[model samples]
Target: MARRNEALLRWFRQTGWTQRELARAVTRLGQARGYNVAPDSSRVRRWLEGERPRQPVPELLAALFSERLGRPVGPEDLGLGSGAPPGGELGWDQRGLVTALQDFTRSDLMIKRRDVLGTTAALATGAVLENRLRGWLDPVRADAAPAASAGRIGTAEIAEIEAATRTFWTWDAKVGGGLYREAVVGQLKAMTDLLEHAYPEQIGRRLFRSTADLARLAGWMSHDVGLQGTAQRYFTFALHCAKRAGDQRLGVEVLSRMARQMVHVGKPREALSLVALARRGAGARIAEAEQAMLGTCEAWAWAALGDAGRVDRAVGTAQERFSRAVAGDAPSWLGYFDQAGLSGMAGLSYRTLAEGDPGLAGRAEPHIDAALRLRNRDAYARSNLFDLISLLGVRIVQGEHAEAERMVRRVLPVTGRISSTRTVDRIRPLARRARADAARSTDAARLAESLDGLLAV
Candidate 1:
């Protein structure tokens, strides 16, 4: 089954464009369509070789191809569709929830691209939103699980898998998601295949749960790689798997990710609604720590929307919950949500509201600083970099160019490696603000110039 139906690659071949030509054409189309796409021909080769496109580009690709060929080209053409090759598509609906979460932990590398080389694939943000809303409204249809019993994957396997995932997560946070996403994705795909083929009923159930975790990670890695639509699809699958496994808490967590993605793309209102839905589900089975983490996330959404009161209230709740959760070991799912994590989130929220209250600058600083203190580079690093960038923006806004320069200089190395478009988006505003508050000889001027140099190529 895996051998013949390379439908996606075939479709690309039919487009009458070489990798270089396709890239050039797409770049031209982006220019015409008013998107700031710094397209490179090498990325086209990655797309042809089964890598998914990142947010903004996937849709742009579809649109560009549609315009050139006079028809619609979907993510599938780029091999990002549901029917991707063996072990490729972590069909969350087929697996159970625990597996989905397990997949989430391990799937980071599968979706990442070479961001340091500027090879991150871009998914059309609108396409992802469209897909998520469509799936939420109409729901994706899941195939019935294969009739197989569970296998002998035991505590050792579970521990090994978890450790591996944590390592990648840490690496992804520190070095860049692009560095490890593919490896994670491929591993999950293989794991899914084995479980689907030979595991027993009892084992199958547990395996499915584990697979769900990997799938979630895969989705996240996809997002990191800039393949928002693919990530959305994977996340939706992970949610379905979680539901099948009867874990409402995990399902809600997936929803939170969806909402976070929305926030990344400037849809705070939609993000807030998604977070609200997550909160409602949190009432069902989440641990105290998870609950607090959700609240902190909610605060971020509210802050993004300029709702100071709600952000404050939500942050307070999050802090209280997090404090209570500290006495015991948190669930594996909630292990990633720690004091530093929540503090970083709080920092972002406060920074967002800093425009109205100068005091927030002080409040945001400590949290951001604490987050940076953590040696564990997981998602926390990528996320906190944004807070630092946000803080730099605030400094620029306050005519503190020297401070802004120092912050940006600190942030650049971190941002350079991560395969996150959102980080780039965050940096853009700071650069613009710096340029606006120009000082010819200041460090802020140098930082802005550096940004311009990077963008020029």
Candidate 2:
């Protein structure tokens, strides 16, 4: 006999669904949404016996229950296990989101439960995406707590937080994310505590916006080190804070970041949807530089979709918008979308397309070269290494083995200094390709051996 799941049993009885019927309904729901879930009656029986289904099943169950109940339901409501921190649920109220963020930040800072917190599995599901979008579009409300009557918070404190966030951003750009993650988490923990206390309405809104900025930075840093699950949580928290601050622009930026993450995780179709949501959220008031950034992200999604025509049009639009952008006209967060950044995105789009159509190899090379030349070596070391790797791949495809070998040699030492798995992922494929063609050229063989030696450690 197994332990009883009272919560699940209650919901099951209320819905009047037999175990087999419920399993069939879940199967139909998943298949209708492009998932291959095929939970049988036995699986549903296990759930009633307190055996939590993996991942997506929990989310799928929640969505099913929510629809049947005519209200939002979550894994917690069904007593299902979740990878999210305490209070982490889709369709949470604003206070719930804040509480979840605080708990998550504390755990992250203490480095407890990292294994559960750092998983990327089940993150890109349709149900999760729809829930998050609905939450973002909902109206902002003031916290239930009254304003502080004694201790007061003001702009100076917010400025200091902003300045620190910028410093962390610079460190992330110069060094890899692993180096500064702890410090950012510490700052965020402190900020979360501050937000919990009372302050004037104006001060409270500014603090929320500032906190959102920090959260977004932390998410980006987590992404740099390839902690996609952790990054997604932070991005979600930032979206909540942005909404609480009544800053639609910041919310749009967070959505764009999430979209980029989706692209990196091989969900380009979902990524395109996120980009569209970000654009819609921005409405007609988006700044030129911000538009450029969104356009580049859109191009990346299109390239991933293998739509060469849409990729070309999107990249062109990005370049044009970026050209029209003037300094100080865009938001501070848009600082990273400079000429070098745009070139890198363009290079990435062309390189992805070139993988299928080698004729685009020539087009990719110049943009990649511009990114390498224009990027500041000290600040963008990791980015530059990725660019070099992309360039090497393009050269190999073009049969310029000598240049490819030279590029590998240049990037190998840089790779040692970086802690990004994504960088290694790109380089490993290039090395394998070179090794496969080693019989054709001595230089290729030498490069392959070198890469193997370097990567073995």
Candidate 3:
């Protein structure tokens, strides 16, 4: 506690913030925004003394400090640290498949809630996700090795679940999340239960890998259904399962996806944190193919965080690593990361950073075009949505409404196919702009109405 308090003090002082100044800033921001807040001096004393602010108030505190200070600040900013001990949050980092599955029961409950998480809640999650990635090279060793499996889960069962998951993934990706999120979540819960009781350790690891994939899909499904808290929980649960499988490569992939979620919800700093962890995890002892996959993901995160230099470095690393990821050279576990996937990731990263760097937008398009040419439906769906977003932004800047509208019409229905929340969220702003643009022109009335209808739904 003393060490934590000292760290908090150092952070505050280094940021040029006094306890009184921070409190004053928080109160002023709150009052201006119509929130009732206590005066700065009292709040400062309480915060400095280690009292955690509760409720809607916590959001206000984070918002006020972050806005004024020009960096992301969470509850930890005020000297209130996690309720869980250091690396205690990383208990999810436990390596035994069974133990990780057991821990999901707690995480599942947290995911199902609808309330806004206070900074502490989010920070706790961020900590777990980040730690898993950062410590990938030196995963916590398990006390008991998993018992060897008798055999694979019957071929029939594996086939059944795989087919269903793939089908739902396709359906959700194309139709809207409103299509089959509940069904997928239900399937995941049931599968998790069955996998827990029936499978031995080695087979259980593979089962848990599938389980984590499904869990992440469930999280994406939740995001589609607008249950962010629930989605976050699933993502966290998926991370645990990935760790349990000793699949750090896939674990980093899941974290990258989680970072994408953060970016969608307008939390770019947290997204940066997740990506940093992914890069840290991929630094050593991972397969070359896995290294490329993680590097590409980190590139995306840096792009989202508006760090051009890091984004370029990561993209370069991703391309080089990806070149080393030949079919003969890489593990079966890494086959999903083909040339098209890497290119899609590169395009997506550039598209994200394009807003802050127009020149990069031009550079991003060729990759986006190449990715689209490959037409891996799901990967293409992601690339198209992001490309549309980037193009729409550029069009808006250049006052090219007709072109932007054309892109929107082509992309919206395409976006409708994937089970990606971030993709959907990205298109919303573009749809809004299109409608507003359409409203201004005599010929655009019908187009504006069409866009408004899409946006309304």
Candidate 4:
């Protein structure tokens, strides 16, 4: 009954793959991500005859096509669905970043998940991200504001916005951004309205910096709540505003945050690319605290790629840079990247590596423990909860299922209180692993059951 999928037929022919071949390829790709996919020739034949497969099959097919063809491919490209890819890529509008921000916020306020992103973080970026990164690496001056509007906000207004942003940021770490992201989005919309107006050049730059910071926080919160497409808009908006304000520190941080999102979603190569750009853009003048942060991001990306040596090197560099940072010397905006933060990043890096090799779980536990020991549990309740989960993961992988079972009791309650979708995202794979090992150990089965409950929110 479907239109016979001419688009899919064309790609199938171009790839020179038979129905069986495509089926096998899709199955292999799916299995790599732990999906129990077992599609055969008949399934691929049905697809060609206009039967669209389920959630991840279309994504897998698109990824396969992209790889074989050496270009970006989305389900829509094969006429299987609609748009560019699941993680939406911002086109970086030609009119201006501000215009794009305005348009994005308008749609966001309407509560529609309209953008097209990669089907999953599992899909390789292929050419799409490379092209975007090229644009990021190039120079492009922002549009100048039309002559200043008569009414203007002064330093006091800028400080207030900054203070508000700091508060929202703290909320993101303390309670997760699930409920408050809408509020942050509304605030950003207001900032965009003010940007449309004008102030003194000094006042304007400060305002833009504040807006950039607010937008970045919005991005972080959106991501916390699992709005990846919406989050990308805020991240790019932050970059545009930071660069427009001539704040290298803000720009580098924005890029770094973007990189973290990429790594979070399983696009490690793209994550590494963003961090490389951030490092190069920061130059030698960048502060030690920022250097440490960037190094940790770089380490995470490398760990995703399964390069333990590179992870070690990056972790070492981060530790050294963090050591060089004078107490209270980092820009106030970077206050979160303290000793606990470094240890968490390091622990997370090893955790990422160990996920692929349970033998390496030992590398992760010490740092995770150190982070838990140093962190202020009350102030960073959400972050502490995430660390606790990470520690549980280490225990499970280390075959210390009894200890991991004990941890699930502590972590499960706090996890329920925290609204972070990232906590869910982070734990899902671990839960899957536990479930897989459950047949062998009663303790692992129990751990899996407990972890599964925490995944509900």
Ranking by TM-score: 2, 4, 1, 3
- What stretches of model 1 exceed 4 Å from their correct place? 1-144, 148-159, 355-362, 373-384, 413-420, 439-447, 453-457
Candidates ranked by lDDT = 4, 2, 1, 3
Name the TM-score of candidate 2: 0.78
Each model's lDDT comes to: 0.62, 0.76, 0.61, 0.77
Worst 10 residues of 2 by lDDT: 110-119
Pick the winner on TM-score between candidates 1 and 3. Answer: 1
Top candidate (lDDT): 4
Off by over 4 Å in 4: 1-95, 112-126, 133-143
RMSD of 3: 10.5
Clashes of each: 50, 0, 7, 6
Candidate 4, residue 222: lDDT: 76
| Candidate 1 positional error at 332, Å | 2.1
Error of 2 at 53 (Å): 21
lDDT of 4 by residue, 1-457 (tens): 8657766887789789989999899889899988888899998888888776886787778778766754344555566543322133433332245544554565466433333222243232647655544455456555556335654678887788888888888888889888688888889988887877756678877878888998999888877777675576577778767766777788888888888988988788888888888877667757888999999999999999999999999999999999898876667888888899999999999998998998888999899999999998887998898789888888888888889888888887798778777888888888999899999999889988887887764
Cα deviation in Å at residue 122, candidate 3?
Answer: 6.0
Q: After TM-score superposition, what is the CA distance of residue 61 in candidate 4 from its true location, in Å?
A: 30
Model 3: residues with Cα > 4 Å off, grouped in runs: 1-90, 93-167, 170-178, 195-199, 282-285, 328-336, 377-386, 412-421, 431-451
Give Cα distance to truth, residue 122, candidate 2, Å.
4.5
Assess every candidate by TM-score: 0.67, 0.78, 0.64, 0.77
- What does the lDDT read for residue 198 in candidate 2? 70
